[model samples]
Target: MSSELAEIEGQISDIFRALSNGFQKMDKIKDLNRRSRQLEDLTDKMRESKRLIKEFDREIKESQYKFDSETTKLLNEKKQSMIKELNSYVALKKRYASNIDNKRVDLFEGPGDGYAEENVMLASTMTNEQLMGHGNHLMDETDQAIDRATKVVHETIDVGTETAASLKAQTDQMSRIVNELDSIHFSIKKASQLVKEIGRQVATDRCIMALLVLIVIGVIAVIIVKIVNPNNKDIRDIPGLAPPAQSRRLLWHQD
Candidate 1:
């Protein structure tokens, strides 16, 4: 009983530890896309750990019946503690996500702000050819940034689609398992009723057989008593047991 909860608890702790390390490492990753991907991985790990915690809670509930009150209370307390830890991580993830989004917004808008000021200064001091060349370079950089953002968006979409499909498959499988369990429960109930009916029929049959045997024994006892005491009239006068009476004298009797 303890073994099951222990395994899940250990897994949750490991995943949480990994998430912490991943977040720390992500801080050092300067590329926006790489950091985003790293964050996604840690998010996935956090999700797994959340699932493990839920499973652990369910396991505790299932085993609670076997535990004393104090033990059950202690288990509940532990579950709450794990939940708080998970929530703290959840908060940390949200904070990091917000920060990333802010950075992304700046990445897109910051250059425009700088260019606005630069254009003013350059327009006053540069030659027409130099101005054209600088404009072209700025355009090229903007196009590259757009392309990178587009690629990141596509990757995120693909990941989301795959995750959705996997979750749906798991949901369907769980539904089938629950349905199978319900059918098995019904079958067992029917079998129990059938067994009870068979037992009743057997009991009734035994009672009838016992009655038949007693009746046969009673008849044999009466016959043995009559033979042992011939003067007993119980059967002596019975027409079938008596010696044939002398044939009634007939009008034409033969000697």
Candidate 2:
């Protein structure tokens, strides 16, 4: 082992030793306040131990490449053992803490809160192991409840994220639909304008055709008058509808 890792492991071992001795002291200490203080000190030691473990982990990661695979595997196993030891101490701390709290409550309860005579009688009859077992069971249930709540919260967050995405997709679709509707409306409006323009063009064409008809009819009347009175010099012959000339008409009359 490297010197740095050795020093870290020593510090961690010292903290664990202190924690084990503190927990042993807690058994004889009847004063709840003193026990509470001892647990607090042990808790601090546990924190330091955890910090050292993290340092150890970092050291292993930094130096594992220098060692063979077997050496590296041993190092990892050592870390896991330390973690299991720390967890046992943590469980012990929780057990003692619960015992102290329950004792405090039992000491100061009012009559209305059901500090019943039979319960105290039963507690007196029960052994320390039974009480500890019951407390452990309660702690386990509480931990399980917290785990379930955490799972439910994560699931709810996932569902909410999916719902938000779906809503966004629906909103985008609606926006596209509205845009298409607007385009269709604009096309209809343009078609209406074109129809109006065509109607005006057709009306103007009909008026021009009527004017042409009137001119053709007037020319035919003038030609008929000229034929009836050939001497009228004021009436001129139209190119296509009137007689060709006085000479052509005289030839026809002579024939």
Candidate 3:
């Protein structure tokens, strides 16, 4: 009995150890589940961030288009104004040359004192000064128009550059988030594998322990039956080895 009790206690200790290992595995499984949930949360957050980044990208594109359109319109307006000024300057020059030719003809062909020639010279001088002024004004306006157009072009280019940089930054950040999500997902998977492996090991140990205990109990029962009646042939002859007196009583009762 002491040996049996000792054996039982040892088996119980082994079973407890196996149960502890199983509990450890359960703990690992729980930890894995928690990490999986965290990964899912992070994935959801990344998806939301990606959605916002897409919206930002769309806004940046729209802003770039508007800037391009406005800048082009401003440049075209400046070009048109310069073209009109150039055309006006050409016409004024032609008119001034025609007036000079007409005055020279009058001075040579009409009968007048030499004072007519002096008046003609004065008229030519005034026309020349006016033409020079108009030329200067046209040049000044052309320069100003070109400067304005250049400024608009540069501003448009700057806007485009900023938009592109913002888009690139958004893309890079999204990529980083995706990478991080993948890493977390992988860690969750690894943890799950470890939990399963540990659980399998614990279950195998428990099965072995149970089988050993069952074998030990069977051996003890066999030893006890053999010790109770060493020379009991009639008892051994019964289907399950009933003792001699017990079988005799059973037969008498049936009769």
State TM-scores per candidate: 0.45, 0.45, 0.34
User: Residue 11 of candidate 1: its Cα lDDT?
Assistant: 91
| Model 2 / residue 123 / CA error / Å | 24
- Candidates ranked, most accurate by lDDT first: 2, 1, 3
Q: After superposition, how far is residue 34 of candidate 2 from its true place, in Å?
A: 0.4
Query: What's the distance in Å from true for residue 76, model 3?
Result: 56
Give the residue spans of candidate 2 off by over 4 A: 110-255
What value does the lDDT take at residue 5 in candidate 2? 90
What is the C-alpha lDDT profile of model 1 across 48-117, one tens digit per residue? Answer: 9888988988998889888899988888898898889888888888988898998998988865685787
> Alpha carbon lDDT of residue 133, candidate 2?
88
What are the Cα lDDT values of the candidates?
0.86, 0.90, 0.61
User: Residue pairs in steric clash, candidate 3?
Assistant: none
lDDT of 2 at 232: 64
lDDT of 2 by residue, 1-255 (tens): 889999999999999998888899999999989999999999999999999999999999999888899988998999999999999999999999999999998888854378467767877888999988877987998899899999999999999999999999999999999999999999999999999999999999999999999999999999998898787653334345555679678867876
The clash numbers for all candidates, in the given order, read 0, 0, 0
The alpha-carbon deviation from the true structure for residue 194 of candidate 2, after best TM-score superposition, in angstroms, is 99
Ten consecutive residues with minimal summed lDDT in candidate 2? 233-242
TM-score: model 2 vs. ground truth: 0.45
